[model samples]
Target: MQTSNDIRTPAEIYDELFVPALFQQWAAVVLDAAKINPSSKVLDVACGTGVLALAAAGRVGTGGKVSALDASPEMLGVARRKSVRIEWHEGVAESLPFEDNTFDAVVSQFGIMFFRDRIAALKEMMRVLRRGGSLAVAVCDSLDHSPGYSTFAKLLERLFGTPVADAFRAPFVLGNPETLLSLCNDAGIENAQVRQHSGQVRFASIASLVSTERACAWTLGGMLDDQQFEELSREAELALQPFAGENGDIAFEMPALIITAHRP
Candidate 1:
């Protein structure tokens, strides 16, 4: 169950496993939702490993600028190695370091759920947007909506306990569309549009899926020890087998609620 990966930090695990499995594809979706274009100044808040920021940089080309911020120096360190074109800042979502009207577009992919004050963060994102600019945010859809994770949650509950399952369910906290809309309204975001977009999750194998989740602090980290992870991996082989393809790859629908708003 344990391997050389056990020594790696959560951010390293996230950048190596979770980003490719879950986040990389969504980066393009977020940038597209924000309508990123050449010459646009962009900021990616809570940018883990600079996936979205790096994509925005390529989309904007040399004519534009991309800056990314996250609270974790560990995560920023991983992101910094990926590209020098982006301005990586270590900061919290609730208080951005940039000045007002600084960016043509601002985005956060799967980071809103952990913010201490969601409304404050939203306001800060809006405050940094130029007029006619856009803000696009993505949060996981409810666990119920994601069939793979729904079953995984049940599996965790049966095997580990409700507390362990609940930790896995934390990312889906803001999955409700109405609740997300209400939060945007409370933040005074104008003309916000919330839409559900289906995304794909892939892992080399069921054990790969379970092990990566074990390493992710955003999910099962600290909740599982070596024995627990080994047990979960054994069970996941059978529990998550339905998602396995002929080649033994695991794939599932991991949808997200994308909220987009344009400043008038």
Candidate 2:
């Protein structure tokens, strides 16, 4: 249960690994649930690198505004560079800076799971959203469903024991729909619809995957120390030996979830 602030440098964490593929898959799903309109003022909470915010900007167009907020200044910086129109704010999800009922819709992707006070963050999201406004959030389904990472996890557990595996489990808190739905209810969001999605996780090589993990030190990178890190990296490379192809590319499928809710 690490707070976003506990991870001091998100820019370093996200430089290599990003939500690009995941975002592309879920953005449409989120937008569909959000029911975006040209006149809708959107708030993207914990908007990392502005994937949803940028997509929201496209949906809102010139008539509306997109206010993207994240605790990580580095993330906000990257998001800012992509689109000047998006009003990027350095803030946390637990306490939003905007006025009450400021947004026509509020959306988050893989963000709510990281909140230290989940209820407070959701309440804030609900508070800022206008009555009848929509809330769409996407979270990782479960570790079992994510084979690319699941296999890696099993291997890591075999090597490092359960403690390390438990640390990795935090990011997949909402993997279960029942738990996620209960959390939504706790936050006062009703009538939530959970949708299932899957995407391909591609790596140019085993080395590429390891590099990406090092670059994005959020979860995978954070768990390992210098010795453990090198050991795991070498193990991963060895594990991928069977999958290595003529071009040395390896790809796998990872499961994802798109959980959407609305204010009653």
Candidate 3:
């Protein structure tokens, strides 16, 4: 509990901050689409802090098996502390450390976009899934679909220039359904069904959003000094006011694409 040099990893920060703000709401949707059942054996790929893994584990219950895989040891460490029953493996998505035709369902939530080689990862997901086993994945939609993030990106580009702020664009790079389906085809995964899903973005206020960004958003946070950040927050508030309610609550719609397929 006491540490001077124990730096918090991105996985730790993601589990504590972004999970509630974003990932938790989508985990069930992903697992449900994968059709995880009490007797199913499940695997969550790129399972940052194991949100989807935990949800699948609950659905699978005592009779089922659940394994969580991530490229980050830090992330796996965080996941292990939360659940010991499920197996945790540190590995990349492109080359899963598992045997072929082993899982009933393989699921990933908001993690497909970050894979270094999405096509290879897709193949690996298929490789590990048994015949007729399902694969379900969710990825954030384009920037325009998320008002708060769009405004923040506008601000980021203004402050840091387009090239740097473009890093923020990575998550939405595969937002298109056509692109998703095409990638699966190229990867030799067949009959993938791609569909859009809408969800809500919620924060107590614009200030709360700004504060969270400052504290945890690595890409754009800490680049500006205190005074500049405060000014940026003020500007962001004005820009986001249309979505703010009378009680000053911030809420907006966010879209994502969910892709599902089964092995031949």
Q: Which is the leading candidate under TM-score?
A: 1
TM-score of each: 0.98, 0.87, 0.90
TM-score of 3: 0.90
- Can you tell me which runs of candidate 3 are displaced by over 4 Å? 1-9, 214-218, 221-228
Q: What is the per-residue lDDT of model 3 for residues 1-264, given as tens digits with 9 covering 90 to 100? A: 422112555566677767877788998899889998999999999998989899998999999999989988878888999898899999999999999999999999888887789999999999999999999999998888898788877877886688646766667788888899999999997789998888877877888776566555435444566776678788888888888999998888888899999998
> lDDT of each structure?
0.92, 0.77, 0.84
Instruction: Give the root-mean-square deviation of each candidate in angstroms.
Output: 1.0, 4.6, 3.1
Of 1 and 3, the candidate ahead on TM-score is 1
**Which residue pairs does candidate 2 place in steric collision?**
13-216, 141-175
| Residue 27 miss distance in model 2 (angstroms) | 2.1
lDDT of predicted model 1: 0.92
Cα lDDT of candidate 2 equals: 0.77
Instruction: Give the per-residue lDDT digits (tens) of candidate 1, residues 27-54.
Output: 8899999999999999999998888999
TM-score of 2: 0.87
In the range 138-205, model 2's lDDT, one tens digit per residue, is 88778887666677777778878887766666567788888877887898877777777776666678
Q: In candidate 1, which residue ranges exceed 4 Å CA deviation?
A: none
